[model samples]
Target: MDTAVEEPQPDEFICPICLELLYKPLVLPCGHAGCFWCIHNAMQGLSFSTCPICRQKYNVCPSVCSPFYYYLKTMYPKTFAQREADIKKEEKDMREQSSPSPTMPEGFDPSSPASLFKCEGCHKFAENPGVPACGHLLCDECCVLEKCVVCSLKITYIPNVCASLRDHIHDNYAGLCSSGPLSSSGGGEVRDKFFKVEGPGVKIQMIGDTTARVEIDEENFLHFHLGCDMCGMFPLRGAVYQCLDCPEKVGYDLCSTCYELQKDVNTGKFNQTHTKDHKMVKRPFNVTKHHLILANNP
Candidate 1:
């Protein structure tokens, strides 16, 4: 009797960003799916955001797709469990490295009005707050933006006023609710100050003097029609790393940064059978090279 574990066959369950099993996956308005953190981190929040795979423009970051989350969990328990453990360890390491020190006063009251619900944008008590797709509560009128100021998640649709929270504020903190609007700044001012809209398509900018960094120009660009699986960089510029062992039509590829940093067990984004043991080759962005890779793999 063979008892060896088998790899998951369904490619849709794989996250495009991390190339791993979709953990806490959020389905975008464009109907594509990616891990919640992946989607959140991918968003620049300064302008319109686009889907990693399809390049569909959107402004809001949506909540976790409950059905996809549970279904993946139930259908592929072992794979999902392994992914969870790996992600947890990674998060723990990150937190330990950058965790901030607590600065609570000696006699802090968690139940106080000031300590209760507060808008993430203005830091005022969210009297008449609206709930966005990311589920973070912001005060009315403060919710207007291309991206959420709190979580930096793109705001796809207008946040609806949370009736329950509105009622709660009305019942408990009626004085604050009836006082005036929570934000001192206008929606236009907030939009201007924080959320400036840049062009929608592929964004290019300069990082520093370094020509071989994240910010590169068309002169330094290589891969014409490829994307980095880890960082979700479309039209992957600079050094592109192609997975030699991935057996998918949409070959597993990565940018130079992701290749160096992320070397974990990731199933390829487009259902490719990529594992940690697989070998990768660095290549320039050329149609011939891309076609050759697909031909060899197929």
Candidate 2:
């Protein structure tokens, strides 16, 4: 009898950004997924961020997808635990090398769209910013919560005003920094102002709203016609990215955004062994090719 426990295959559950087991995976609206920190690092604050693979545009990072996060944890406990340990060491090493500097926030630049430090909760320019462990900048007013609304990470350190950052913004980028916090009723005003400034097609997900919607209205969420194989969004909605190369009759399909992000990820939710060699085609919502495949298979 073989008693050795087989290790989980690296190719099955790896994050494209980190090239390791997915940890605290956050599924994007495009149906692609990435590790929380990886997404955080990739996000272009104050502007629309693009999918690392497909370059699909998005703004506001989301919290961890609870279902997928737990599934990976259960399926590959050993590898997940090892990845956690490795990340901790890497973070510690990174912190040790970089002492606090007043040059400017790493991702912030006056010349770029990410010039301002926007609150993750309200999407308002944080005059006095609160830096959390996850590094999602928030206004002091939005920092009242104990957990980060963006990643749901526990706030280990009190969110204090980064004076150095504040001074840098004021001195270098005159008028970019707001003079003070918005009024209590300024949520709408802030949103309107952001829209006017950022222009149309720009979206900023208020982390708090996402939390409330998930808890209060998840059961009432709309279901689409087909499910995305990558994000597990049942009754997949929007543009469907269908694989043209997989031999499985059940078919391999991803959300268009996910298709672009997961080009390297060739596996499927239903056991379709898709590979990088597989070609995919994007189908609009009205297209019946996917339905035809399902109908014929059944």
Candidate 3:
């Protein structure tokens, strides 16, 4: 007696449309495979003239339920049931996870007067208190005076206590803010600009012609500039210098046009000098002409 051999099953194929195990596989001319329902839904709105896979030009309609469906129903019945069960379980879990929680922060009494704290500047009681300048409390108005404590000159309003002090004092004192406004004798006004020089230090107003001031930092460095002084001109004219090696002119200059022209001239001169030097360096072996001839021949 002869025995029969069982054929290997095709259970690993997946449908591209539903992204599940293919229940009814259909192959297009381009050899791409998808489920029957996926292809039908995709072609329903569009003209039924293109292959669903390679999009090859074809006018024939897809064939109806064939041997693929029967094979799926008989061989993979358990797989289909398992996939449906997994989907239902996932949906149930999602619904449970989306439910709201019941909790609140400690000391969150909204109605209690004792829970309220006052703003140092405004003196108004709220849920929070405003702390400024080393735990010093001030009303919002005093905090936003927009004036330097040391000079009394109007400075830009920076909200933080440290930023305000830094702008007012620059980097002068170790801990204390400046004693509001330096006297004019130390650095008198010039061309509507004030200049203050103490020892090797110098402070100049880079902006605001009529009323401006300087602030020093903790390291005694003046880093802040205010106003539209100089109409945005450079601090000095002759401060700019030409480059030593290259024909490039660099450094700070007052006029933008003059600075740009100097840069262009310097760059051109540098390039010319570089080209001449390069040619001279290659003069010992006359190889440049031979290389050029070979390159041209190609």
**Per-residue C-alpha lDDT of model 1 across residues 116-188, encoded as one tens digit per residue:** 3566577676776665554455776667776667546555455444433354355556677666433332111
TM-score-better candidate, 1 vs 3: 1
**Superior by TM-score: candidate 1 or candidate 2:** 1
Question: Stretches of candidate 1 above 4 Å error?
Answer: 1-8, 96-298
Candidate 1 backbone clash number: 8
Q: Evaluate all candidate structures by whole-model CA lDDT and list the values in order.
A: 0.55, 0.51, 0.30
- Runs of candidate 2 with Cα error greater than 4 angstroms are 95-197, 200-298
When summed lDDT is taken over every stretch of 10 residues in candidate 3, the lowest stretch is: 225-234
- Give the Å shift of residue 271 in candidate 2: 36
RMSD of 1: 15.9
TM-score of each: 0.34, 0.33, 0.22
For all predictions, the C-alpha RMSD in Å is 15.9, 19.4, 34.2
Model 2: how far residue 2 lies from native, Å: 4.7
Q: After superposition, how far is residue 171 of candidate 2 from its true place, in Å?
A: 56
